[model samples]
Target chain A: MPNPDAGGHWGEFGGRFVPEALIAALDELEAAHTAALADPAFMSELDALGREYGNLPSPLYLAERLSEEAGVEVWLKREDLNHTGAHKIRNVLGQALLTRRMGKTRIIAETGAGQHGVASATAAAYFGLECTVYMGEEDTRRQALNVARMRLLGAEVVPVTTGSRTLKDAMNEALREWVASVEHTHYLIGSVGGPHPFPMLVRDYCRGIGDEARAQFLERTGALPDVVAACVGGGSNAMGIFTAFLDDASVKLYGFEAGGDGYGTGRHAATITAGQIGVLHGARTFVLQDEDGQTIESHSISAGLDYPGVGPEHAHLAASGRAAYEPVDDAEAMAALEKLARTEGIICAIESAHGLAGALRLAKSLEPGARVLVNLSGRGDKDMGNVVEYFDFADRKGQQG
Target chain B: MRAEAAFATTRAEGRAALVGYLPAGFPTLADSIKAVDIMIDHGADLIELGLPYSDPVMDGPAIQRAADQALAAGFRTRQVFEVTEAVAGRVPILVMTYWNLVERYGVDRFARDFKAAGGAGLITPDLIPDEAGEWIAASDEHDLDRVFLVAPSSTEERIASTVAACRGFVYAQSVMGVTGARAATSAAAPELVRRTRAHTDLPVGVGLGVRSGDQAAEIAAYGDAVIVGSAIVNCYLDSEDVPAGHQRLAALTADLAAGVRR
Candidate 1:
């Protein structure tokens, strides 16, 4: 299979489709990216930052119980253990370093579940750059702890009230703020969406996870995993892992999208699974839009997975059949969340649980000796309350024999 | 004297032409159409009708606010074309818009409808020449001129490439940023104009900050066209009523057009 990034597009997707306000910024980023790719000094600086600040080379752990239960060997890429407790720190560190290199004084970001906000705040604190995070009012209320955490790190958290009062609205507010302050501020987008150079740049920064994981998996198993699975929201983690393995024909890539109830219910974030190819968030990608082309509301138990669009690379991967996408329902993901906690003693984010659930289903259909790798995208610490409340886990635990 | 005659005479003297920009339906759709007729009646050889977007990222606060107001007043893509259709090709009409709206409206349909509405061209401020392949075919199919912008920061290589891809004329941004009226034009604009002229035979029109008659004259002296956008947009904002707004825009357009020939 050809590398989708060959045409500077991810399979006829992911071009710089932005307003003129961002042209200069994107151009500057493109120049810096070109320089950084060629300059060993720049690479070394980013390497040092990743090592010291982002806690690079996150572990790849074999899930013994999960493997036994599924009758297949399962390995987990432990991005959940990274600093700030998620994979977001990887991109944030890279961008914050780039911001400093560009001599920008401030950073602005948008958050849905506040993982990106926390990561941005952490990076801002490390770099001593003033940071402002725009979060939808509903998200601020739901993720109050992360909001406090950002404020504690000296970053301002502004509640955005527009559109649907969610991640999309927050993103719009951040874009508006960036437009207003393009001279000295960098808008640190959280995921692998948005205009050119961003999707490519963010993917490059986060690809370290897959790079390290592939090597680690090969070292441990003496062969590549039959399938690599990760949950896809804006598809940052999935793209991170899938990109490195794109050229490996034998390795199957799977992206699990959130199916709130079911794809037929028209209330899921199963963009690649149910959406048609359309332009959204500055790139041509799969979007869950109505027949009239109006973007429809998407729902998920996890706030992070409630976006109506998927990253462009994911769309390309799915279209080319290099990657398979499946939607995981709320119940299935919650069940996987609990199962992982009890079996592996690792509490995974509800978003990541979708991957685990997908892996379990895939394991059932595969050969008994098949090996699979699931990207444990984040820890479930941020979602403990919701998990407990939604599943009645407290009562269920007491009722357990 | 007719505005077309003034422009023709200036072109015969090897002088640049003059283009004017007005937000489609600035004070009202009727007022905006009246302003367009007035500008063409006075001197605007080519007119850029800015399709107001909810988020006009490239525009400064004034233009952004004006766009927001226009959108609130039920301005839309179809309505802009409707206004163009009413004008009936008295002059070339260029639709200036952000790329998202263009993508959403379907580039092929937009190009077809725009041409069918008597529009001569389209100026996608955000669309880079390198990424314009898909829309280029659509524009060609519809026989609409695809105008590209060249900024001060554009490299020589990019300038040549963009100029080659562009039809009609190349919009030369006078400054680094977006559309807004400025107290004075950039000192580097004339040199930029000269540099752009060396690269392409296409007419180069300077935009982004031309607000006064003096600035228009200064730019027209060096370039193939001088574009004044925000100053004209401000004229409508300053008026208390639609009639007053149209009258103000007409008088301002005549004054600016006269300045180019002086």
Candidate 2:
């Protein structure tokens, strides 16, 4: 329940841990964002773009078959149905509008799953601004479709092969790019993470997901669900959906982190669950780092969830006991992903599957008729190739032979 | 402070000090040690030994590459001590690091171990004054100098506060960007120095995009010291032969040292 200080500290967890050169740029961004939100003309423009371009008001659907199988009603806030097939568009579109407000013409972003990059590219195309994306080389290979999607949208993609060649390193490279190019460029961060204004800004833009789902759930059930769940990577969708329920004491927030091989293996990205609180990517939050404070590599089968750090707001919420976090392993997430596709016929991204898996478990503990809401943050189409490779569908043969 | 001593000596000589940088554990740990020695022997009055990190947001491609190579070669926090021990008594050595390393290594422990290794201080590019409670307290406990950076975009209030927090000379970034060598000196460098100077009687060192001797000389004319990193890192990174790179590093340091005298 603790709010961030005026200087952007989420109770010693979130501060501008950047060079002095970037203070001016972050100040400019924070000021412009505040001004834009306060202006009716700007807010209306952003809302119009959200409706026209991003296909806002993402539907909330009751997964009937899933409900029957689990003996509990499960509602899905379908962020997957957004324009870029993910919740990432909400942040990008808002920041893209902010870029114009700041009188900048260039937009840069860092991506791991490439969902955010594609979203940023889509916004840039709409706004007629030049776009560039920095993706870790490993992520580029893992999320090839999203890379091509960004490129096809006319955004230049730079593959960062530094450090672990993952999301953390890609963000470092993106910050470097921003420092040199801050005047004419806006770094369109895609998560509820990073330095000030970004985490808050991204959350504000995405709160519409929670707003819509809350209304839809109310109309159908006449009450809020007992539990609301979402996967946490850099944790945009989770923050988005959780924002609406912050004041509702009965709505228990559950954030599922990626437990790649499980906590014992030290290979997971379950930062809040198993890692220590430290600064990374400008935010002081739970991070997987070495004894020397160097960030350790994080592994996740779901590219979107393969990050070493969590958002600072989530850290504050966790500290206040307003939210509880759990880790869902890769195998569990994949099982839930396959199950959702089979039962609901609505494929879920591997990242969102973590939440689905957690929901399934939470439902068993609750009353049989209890309701649970999950944020389906992205579509599964981009993950089909990885799923096939992971389950070895290409190698599986019919037993009849 | 050792940095103050070096600056005093240089000022007495009627010249701005040549501040050199080299990433610890670069090329190889052993070669990195030799490189630092070469720089100090050639002309550097102050040494900024980079503690190689996994994510260096403030660094450009060259320094990042050097750090990546160092880290790839099994570098860790202990390696910083090793390099510092090897280069002790040559010049006032300041470990240029991002804040995470200190936080991870435990600020008190890092300061103690560094002081034990005869290190002068730390130049934290990321840790600013307002959020620098731990570093400031640790430095005081260890009696070690703590350097802070100021930029062209720094407000008067910021410059004043940053200078107030600094023990050594104020690091006045030449531009509003990360570390790298530039084709020409930033137009904002001299003005940034002037602004920081207006805030404090403390010496001001200019950095960010300063590459060649010509650029160093221009910065030296107004600034108290010229801190160069990516340019020195570039020497070893681009050289086909590391020994030649070592020679080039010394030669470059000598050239910059001469420029500071102009």
Candidate 3:
């Protein structure tokens, strides 16, 4: 197991590779991050915000039904219960506070499924700063409800039409906007990807989940779980939980990637499970790219899990064998979603179902008493349409002809 | 102001002649030409006619928007050559561009047509030095000065190698970042100029974030020539019409040139 304060370089996976236009912004972020690490005043400010605004220290609930079904003891760290209904608010609040400290007046963010946009808008509203979000035209059309949510939250949503019309296009649009407004606007990147300080900073803010979970788990179970499971999209949620348990050699960490159809079909966003080491976005990470280094289109039933690249820190974790990555196909994840909805009445997002599915499979292979902790990354409220459509539940109920 | 004599003199000066940059087809090609004429009129010595690419990574938003507008108006490689040819060697023209447009245009034909159009130099902002040797040789055959940029992050050995292969004055990026106009010049520009001077006697002109007359004057104290780009492009954005834009630019350049001379 590696040390926690290891400068966010999982091994050689995380480093800054941004355009020259962003050097100043990145440098300022790095400097502020360094200062915040040592300054108790900055730390306490974030702590207060987490408690008052973000509803920090979310509970680690023992999933008695899930454990009984899987024949293993299972627990969940409920990050989906956060203020923004996902883990994204944790990072956004921290970054928004830092933006105020830097004297910046504007905030810009790019979103795929609009979770990050909602979180960023929430932060901007709290801080009284102007906010703008760039989302791909395709995503905007598919996630119309989230777009309306952002608008209602007082953040302008600009639809990007370039590239593949997905998260990649939104990112390119955001980069263009950042280059133009580099002076007074801070780009609030959503996940543990992009350049150096971003992955490090987002991970630092979200690490509270793992820290609290570790202490709570010890108090309840008398020891850490044998395995920790979390779904890896941009890997923020997984890294947040894994960071605290990285040094616990007895605990095995598993990250489940979206295997759209399956790794064999080659249409998945399972970068760690199916990709080679390469560069994308800004960091050197495992990416689904061709020989010429062009990014390939990825597929997933879940829009949030359709990105072609994973966080650089996840790449490092995969490389060092500190973490094991497995892919959960569309069918399997969908099944897990239904299983949780029926068993526990907790409708989990299709993305979070990847972790749920992985936990079930791992439980089947392990001793009946072995404990597993799954980071239930988000709720299924945003994904109800996809679940209903994929399962044809309304048609079976005779609600549709 | 003929390009042949300017190239010959530039070679004799033991330094690359300064090629001032102004976005082509910006405001309008008609007024863009006047801005070019104004640069040549005020001892610009050489000129870089920027053929705006859709994705200009090395450029700031102001220049990027200018390029986007130029592109939106159907500004292609052939139009860039036609515009330069219209100048008729009043000053040497270098087509600064992204490689994708050049690849689409066919590099050999693009090189030949560019030189035949009274152009005397070429600068590819995105070309890495390791991959530029073949193009450098091709440009030499066509008798075009190949300009290159040196940054703060470039290693000393890489700088020497690139400078030795380079034909025109080395473009000294004043800051560690991309092309933009700033309220003030970068504090690092002086040290960067000093470091560039140590390796090659090529007249180093500092660019990126140079916006005002006072900053140009300060840079001119150390640099052999000061390169102002984003400021001039932003001036075009400020005006409603092309001729009005060119008139504004001419006045601004004259003031900046005077400060540089002082």
The estimated TM-scores of all candidates read 0.82, 0.96, 0.70
Instruction: Please give the ranking of all candidate structures by lDDT, highest first, separated by commas.
Output: 2, 1, 3
Task: Candidate 3: give the clashing pairs.
Answer: B16-B169
Task: Give the alpha carbon lDDT tens digit for every residue of B200-242 in model 3.
Answer: 8766777888776777778777876677788888777888777
DockQ of each: 0.20, 0.80, 0.08
| CAPRI category for model 2 | medium
Global lDDT scores for all candidate models: 0.82, 0.88, 0.78
Best by DockQ: 2
lDDT of 3: 0.78
Residue-wise C-alpha lDDT for candidate 3, range A158-261, written one tens digit per residue: 99766577887687678767866777999999888887778888888888888999999999989999999999888998988999998899999999999999
Best candidate (score: lDDT): 2
lDDT of 2 by residue, A1-401 (tens): 23478778877678878888788888899999889879999989988888888888888999999999999999999988988898888888889989999999999999888888898999999999999999999889978888999999999999998787888888999999998888899999989888886888888888888888899999988999989999999899999999999999999999999999987798899999974888888878888888888888898898888888989999988887999999999999999998999998888899999999999988889998888999999999898898888887775466532
Per-residue alpha-carbon lDDT of candidate 2 for residues B202-230, written as tens digits (9 for 90 to 100) = 88999887778888899889999999999
- Model 1: per-residue lDDT, tens digit, B13-113? 77667788877867677877888888888877778888876545466656766776776687767888888887756777888887756777788988888
